[model samples]
Target: MRKPRRGAVILLIVCLFFLPSCEAIDNDFSIWDKLFNPVWDGDFSSLNYKATYPENNVTSGGNMEAWLDIVGWFNMSRINGTDYIYGDPANQSITEYNAIDTLGWNDNMDWIKHELLYDVVNDTLIVQDNITMLWHHSEEKTTSEGHTYIQKTYYYSYLTVYDSEIIPKQYVYDGQNIEALITFYNNSINPKSVIFIPDKLGLYSIDYTYKNESVHEDLMTGYVENNSKGIEFVNFTYNSGWSDPGGNLSHIGVCAVVKGGNFTPDNLSIDIYTPYEQLNITNYNLSTCNLFKGERSMHILLFPILLIIFSPFLLIYFIYKRAGR
Candidate 1:
């Protein structure tokens, strides 16, 4: 009887802890089964951290390690036309005007310029990107397969994501007719705001803020200075000054084609990075970009592909060498 009573209490606590996490996903549960499956789905695009922390006051069990449900989905196109919603239209944070091609998102800084101040007392740093996305104010299921294990599963929208919007002034979800903040135009920009900061301590922070307003604003404290120093204790951001060499290697400076030699760093840094909000893959369809990411054995096949492309030349050279012999 004591064991049974203890079990009930644990179960209730577990439910309350995970309930907020559920809000980020949709109804389907099959995708979750793949979470632990040994088989590779060949879709790294489908491979994402969970749907991310729910924005509308929901919490990730007080540890928002999955990042936050930090992006919004807007209908950038019309039913009669193609997806003007560029790239994967999945984790985008900026907005663009359909009319004017040049002067874009009238107030774009709201999304990128934020200071996630480090807490000296708590030894933590917390900040948010695109708080207006919460206005998008945002369900679940399960299946039987011999319940040998209990894993928390999350699913994403096959719809609904693109089906909603809550951009301020420029757009309101479901035609809500409102204005707020953040408007950026230019190539579906989803800049990693945290990356822009020079003194960022993201690699070291260990906890997330539990109770408070979700709009994160506080800069990383002074720690590392590259070629220059930022204001004292100010968390400065730095978008790479180098121009894109024409493709999607966001951190072009780290790539072999660009600045590829000793991959070791002179300072404390992360090699690859996406926007903190990019982990919020709520409306993103994972199927669209697997081949591009070189997942699904695309990297495995690259050798065969190159071998075939140059096989004829190799054969000719081989025959010429044999004839010479």
Candidate 2:
């Protein structure tokens, strides 16, 4: 009995020695999180920042961070807005918005569902967004529309520049706007107020009204994938219901603020050329990941296999030694 107990202890030690070094693999971390863990990326010190969307007091609530993997989402503001308000008679941009994080609220926008999915091949994130608007979230509705509001699928892809910053690679968001416009026009319903964001070089807002697609068609004809002047920031607003207290949780607009502040819209007070010149694009995926660094990674990954093979021999040796004693 004593011999068997001693052998058992040896086996446990062996098991401990052979476990995978990456804690994320075995733990609750999603495969997406495990694969794209920032630890493996080299020197993302640039993307690491304390504040995002400093304007409009975005930091007032918080930000949807995208260091390399779009760290966390904000309330889900879909686009940015400036003093430049668009639409006819009344503005249709997101006037009411939420700045809090998803995890902070127990709402319909589950953190798990909306979390950024990792695209291993390209090192990108597939952002999934589906939420109702704030005014429409209320149980009671004044609009002729029966359901009050509809949830539209808003998904986009973002690329990580490793140590640098993340950018929109696919430029699929323009199609999204078209879909939303079709819905509002088809249903003949007035949407929420919009804050026209004039951060681009030559931004022109369509004097749009409820159910008017022709006016906005020219504006949406082609989306700007690359803002040569560099994009100031982009915001997205989405609404989630407050399940607990039983009311609207308001709206959340996720802001992806550029860190270096190198790019400002065609501003009169700010020097666009100076800021644009200051912009720096770092080489992406230049170094090996943190844990899986060169041959060292191989050894770490293989450590367990070696230990398993040696454990039996180690146990036998220990038993022989104990008997001799």
Candidate 3:
């Protein structure tokens, strides 16, 4: 009777201890929190403090100060807006926009489905109906020549809706306008290239290239003289050169044709180029920069860690059953 009573008390205590805690149930949404994380919450922008790109021109310098100062992102304005606006956590800027992150609101992984349904056909990353204008991601460098390159691909495809109808299924965005933004950081010493096409009945394609540093900006916008060939080929020597600490300031050029038409009534292919001269092209992957330094998303490994943490409960249950036998 004493032994049985002692076992009962121990079992009661164990049950109380093993029960889920309210604190665990109250876990905050990490995704939403990370989205609103500000680079400069106060008046850092108002102050006349202009930050220089990394000294070596490397994209990620593993500097805490740099990340702190240059980290936050502003709310994207409408397709046609007068000025940029900072995002408010309480309010959403783009109603239909979906973040490209791996997790969803329910913590269920559904990015793959979204990619196939939207990202595949749009020819652009559609985040909440609004196209991702500029994407800044880092990649690791392998060889000496191309150690690492920071890819900043801009998406400008607009679906013009007229009379409640989707006209011109999809339009090729102006590469020239997007190229101007690239020059703000890099120099144009290397050669550049571009390809463009106007849709006669459907969608047209646009492709352009710019170097790390260059002096001259190349404006090569070509029309599809022949649609059957897929794309018209244009080869030109790039004379423009820009300064760079990495030494080589050049980029390989390539383009593809999606549509074709004749002289006047048809559309014209338009593209331009200007590369960054002063900025250093560091060899590193942008996506995993934070991970390399021990900073990572806890959500990624949460499940596995939890499994290990709870495994002891199963062992205790088995031991209890054996003792009862």
Candidate 4:
């Protein structure tokens, strides 16, 4: 066997210094999995919450009541109806009115400005509103005493979303009177599903399979489902400038809301799995392939540096072979 040249030995040493060892590669792959494929493996007891809005009358003959039970996850709707205008009491601002209009409440009713309050200690969410409505009734024909009679009724409404799980709950004080409380229960019934992509690049085309047979979209598809069964598998996407300090990606479970009447749960228990974990592509600046704050800069620079360092040795080997030929 011929001895290796001094230049070859030096190049080998350079490769050893720059290239990642097998152990290093394995360690790196594990880190990559942790960052991108974060497993949902922790106690989920914090997810259990019971929301109750007691029945009450803001005005005589007009009552409101609602309740929601959350077991695993929750999400709130984006303010799609109108921009919330602060200091606008009547909610007359075009944006504020539009927001109320989006809820599809009675047009005769006036929407007062709405606000949300959170109690950290109790883990309760409160929604307060000021609403007003005019109720009118008239008898067109003969009345009880052999004479035409007309009766007019007026209702003044005030609403609040007290001790709730969902955010920005809508209350109409429209006197519609809900007879039964709406209830939603998410019982842990199925194992959380995990998808493994062979490469990070494959994430763009990956499709997540949800255990809920009703789910039609992947975790990233951002679909909202509000059906007769109540809202489930809804993803809440916030508008620009809105930030969720809770660090949750869309409400990824089940929820139920009753406007003003009795709701009976046909299926009281559902298999509520933990929210799926995903690698957010927006965190990376795709144009530059640069991770935010240079977190992955070392990984990005490694391959290029290795290529540059080995080019001269490859060129030398080509030239020596040509000369020998």
Candidate that scores best on lDDT: 4
lDDT, candidates in the order shown: 0.25, 0.26, 0.25, 0.29
For model 1, residues 49-137, the per-residue Cα lDDT tens digits are 22232334332211111123323322222111111232233333322111111112321111112122211123212233221110010
Candidate 4, residue 161: lDDT: 40
Error of 4 at 81 (Å): 32
Number of the candidate with higher TM-score, 3 or 4: 4
Prediction 2 TM-score vs. true = 0.15
Supply candidate 3's per-residue lDDT for 74. Answer: 23
Q: What TM-score would every model get versus the actual structure?
A: 0.14, 0.15, 0.11, 0.20
Clashes of 2: 26
Any runs in candidate 1 off by more than 4 Å, and if so which? 1-231, 235-281, 288-325
Of candidates 4 and 2, the better by lDDT: 4
lDDT of 2: 0.26
Model 3 — which ten-residue stretch has the worst lDDT? Answer: 63-72
Best by TM-score: 4
Q: What TM-score number comes out for model 1?
A: 0.14
Count clashing pairs, candidate 1: 15
Off by over 4 Å in 4: 1-122, 129-131, 137-163, 166-230, 234-325
